[model samples]
Each structure stands twice: as structure tokens, then as C-alpha cells.
Target: MADASLFEVDTDELRRVGNTMVGIGDDVAEVARTAPMDGRGEWGHQGLAGAGDRFGARYRYLIEQLAEDVDRGGVSLRGSANAYEEMDAINAASIAGLGMDW
Candidate 1:
């Protein structure tokens, strides 16, 4: 048995969660890309035009940043999963070379 104090990992779960995060990021990015940036004529008040533009720009920046952050998180998760799996394989190989039977 592994040491109780050591951390355990489920690589498949990590990959699954990573995929979900990537999909969510893609969805968020699509919305951010498609959303209208200019609300100049949409609002009845002329004073709202400037505010709308400013808000739109800020919203776009925030949404895009969120998408990028989420995407990077997913990538990081996948990388960790891959690293764990690779390490497991290497360990297995080393054990086999030692002719140790469990």
C-alpha cells in the first residue's frame, strides 16, 4: 500500500475534468467574440452611449481573460495527468527490470 501521507491521483479523472474546462473555455470565448461591442444606438439615452462603450470594452477584456485563464488551467491539468501517467509507466518499467513480482 502507498503511504497514507502521500497524495493520490486519478489521471483519468483529471483528463476528464480538463476536457470539460477546455470546452467551457471555448464556449466562453465564443460568446466573448460574438458579443456586440458597440451599444451606441441601442440605448435611448445619449449619455448611456459613452458608458455602454466603456462597459462593453471592459466586459470584453474580462471575458476574454477568463477564457484564457480557464483554457490554461485545463492545459495545466492535462499536463499534470500526462506527467503522472508517464511516471507510472517509468516506475512499472523499473520494477519489471528488477524482476520483482507483486
Candidate 2:
């Protein structure tokens, strides 16, 4: 395993990735909003219609949950980038205070 101290983070890259994740989450949410899986009157048989409705409800619930989770992940990633950037700034300031150029 690589040493933790040697790890490097690209804040810009993190922000970009976070933004992409957010976009994907938004797209997923749009899908859930636009394509509701309510197969009530479509099925010919009553039993099949009921089953389809149940499945549709479950699918909508799961998709909504997934969208929320993904959005949270993206937000977390963006927050992490900000935290890392701040930490880097503090470290550089500390280094500069020691009569050194960082």
C-alpha cells in the first residue's frame, strides 16, 4: 500500500468529479420524475396489473433512494475538496512562517 503521507490530491480534479457526479444524480432524478413506473391500466389482466403496480412502486422507491445517495456522495466529495484545499493552504502558511518557501 502507498504511504498516506505521500498521497497527493488534485483539488480541481476532485471538484470536476464531484460536479459530474452531481450532474449524473440530477439526471437520474429527472428520470425518476419523468418516467414513473405506474403500470396500472396497461396490463390486460387484473393480477398482472396489480403485480406491475407493485413492481413499479418498488422501482420508484429504489430509484429515488439511489438518486439521493448519489447526490449526497457528490456533495461529500465537493466538501472534501474544499477541506483539502483549506488544509493545504494552512500547511503552506505554516511552512512559510518557518522562513521557508512552500
How does each model score on TM-score? 0.78, 0.82
Best by TM-score: 2
For candidate 2, write residues 1-102 as lDDT tens digits.
111112378777778889998899988887777545454787688898888778777887888888989998898889988888777778778887999876
| C-alpha lDDT values of all predictions | 0.79, 0.76
* Pairs clashing within candidate 1: none
Q: Which runs of model 2 end up more than 4 angstroms from their true locations? A: 1-7, 36-39
10 residues in a row with least lDDT, candidate 2 = 1-10
Model 1 spans > 4 angstroms off = 1-8, 36-39, 42-47
The residue-by-residue lDDT of candidate 1 on 10-75, one tens digit each, is 877888899999999999998788656555778788778877878878888899999999999999
Instruction: For candidate 2, give the lDDT of residue 8.
Output: 73
lDDT score for residue 27 of model 2: 87
